[model samples]
Target: MQGLVQSVFDKLLPPACPTYTGLLPLITTLLQDRSCFRAALSKGLGLGIVAAAGLIKLPQIVSIVTSRSSAGLSKTTFLVETFGHTYNLAAHVRQGYPPSTYGDFAALLVQNYVLLVLIYAYSGQPALGVSIVVGAVSLLGGMCNSGFPLGLLQTLTAGNVVLVFASRLPQALANYRAGSTGTLSAVTCVGMWLGATARIFTTLTEVDDPSILAGYVAAAVLNGIIAGQVLYYRGIKSRRGTQPSPAKKVQ
Candidate 1:
């Protein structure tokens, strides 16, 4: 019985895993090892964020599909986002970090591509969509290939701080100007903020890569801005809806 229990935990929390590993120490120490415990918790939360990333954008996708319109959606926003995420994903994979540390980049890249295609196709520019996707894939894919330079990847990843700001700024500005978050899913915006914030902790605890850390910090702040816009607009919309309209003129 003891051997079976140890064997299961060994597989579950292998030493190669970038977190608190052995179950016996965790149990015998009564969780008194603060650093180890924090690492374990961070790892768990990182994995949770990764799992949520897989579906985090579905709400926005559904909103656009149901409305049959990509109104208020920014093509530049998604395009730049794809560009940033692709680089981030490539950098992380090449850096050999555990997937838990940067899994959101992969998931978000796919979601952003879908959004770009949908926005283009619905806007009557399917050819442009195909072109952009192919072009981006070819260009970014080639850069990430073998013989690619790590120094360049590091520079690009560091630049993601700027890219993250650019990606979120337009959407937030659009919401401010329109006084509405049209077809933007509150779920997706809020999820982005939460995920970005969580990544900050996980990055600190796990990888501690400066470029990745800076990017997540910027992402958290910027995503918060967009999420705040969503909430503020929603409140305004609700209040307006509740306000009594002027009594209809008596016939």
Candidate 2:
């Protein structure tokens, strides 16, 4: 069975594009090759992280859409964080990372932008929501296609570290103030923590980009903080013997 799968992957990927192979299938193949198993494992983990990164924000998006409220979401945080993802996307592209590795950043950016727009729209700022959507698309397009300065790209890449903190701190604080997660998906918080933690190792393995590594490390720490806040707030609610408030009207 393993041999058959390997044969299929080889036929599908071809010699010219070994990097294009799916990570798990590649791992299975690597396990078959004793000499390079460690290296293959590392690369496989990195690819898995890349795939996971694309979905990290999904719970938050779904929570907002289903609840029709961006409660517990910080607009400023998401707006700034979306820029972080945007910068990461452009930086990854500029550095010539394979699409298999970095393409999900594009998907992540788009989804985050959509969430941002939704937040604004829910807040009764439809015009602002539309403007952010347009502005982010335009900026991302220019960054991807145009020959932007290397220094600027580097700066943006490095700035991702700060953005990671900026993104989650407000949300954490909001949770603190509200005394509840308040429509914030516990799944989102926990997933982010786990994902960011895994990203650190996977990044060190595949990307080995200093800025990107720093970004993931900081992101992991911040996400851990947010997860801690969620747990802490949950405890507080339990201690106070208070049940959750009824849902707010969907704006």
Candidate 3:
């Protein structure tokens, strides 16, 4: 049944290129029998939904780079995300598992790295200094494991989530209240939303760790809120555009 579902998802969204090729045989095998098709389709649909969510972050990413400003970008969220992924990596390492299993580690690494660069480009020394401090702490936590050290590492990991969510809440609320995303890039917002959605499904379908699942869910909700704000702002802008401006009185 699982195999059948995977096959359908493969057919609809179709894994990107080289990756999908490897699964092609498994997918084909399931399709050969009619009885398994429905189950396969169900699984495929779930995967598709996740895939759609993953695409949401693309818009936000593009917007930040193109505009060269972190205007609406929240440093705290990225900081928390970076720390969270770092902790996850440490946990995987401690358990003798590969880090890639978490998926978000790679995405977070890229997102946080690029964000730091963008922050530095616009905000300069202070931002860079903060990034350095956070990165240093994250690095130490991931590498060292001694008596009390292990406990400290675990704390850092847990703390990352708290800091990120706490930091993001205000910005999210501000965007929602203002009904304007301001300098926040539309591309990045969309991409982040999709990525977050995908991450949620990825947790549901792929990951097993309860802690990781919790983190992903938290991130997903935050991303969804941000996406909602951007979409709402766009709707308002569109409506205003359609409405005619009041006529000026004759001099």
Per-candidate TM equals 0.89, 0.78, 0.65
lDDT of all the models against the reference?
0.83, 0.74, 0.59
Error of 3 at 17 (Å): 22
What digit string (tens of lDDT, one per residue) describes model 1 on residues 1-251?
A: 76777666554442433333356665644367566567667878988998999999999999999999999887878988898888787888887877888788878877877888899999999889988888877866776686788788889987878998788889888888998888889999999999999998888888857888898899999899888988888899999999998998888
Query: Candidate 2, residues 150-237: lDDT per residue as tens digits?
Result: 6798887877778887887888788778777876667768877887777676566557678888888888888898888878877777
Best of the two (2, 3) by TM-score: 2
- For candidate 1, the per-residue lDDT at 85 reads 82
Compared with the true structure, the alpha-carbon lDDT of candidate 2 equals 0.74
89-186 in candidate 3: lDDT tens per residue?
66656655322344445454555665666665676655674666577565845454543355565565555446548756867977867768766766
The best candidate in terms of TM-score? 1
Candidate 1: give the clashing pairs.
none
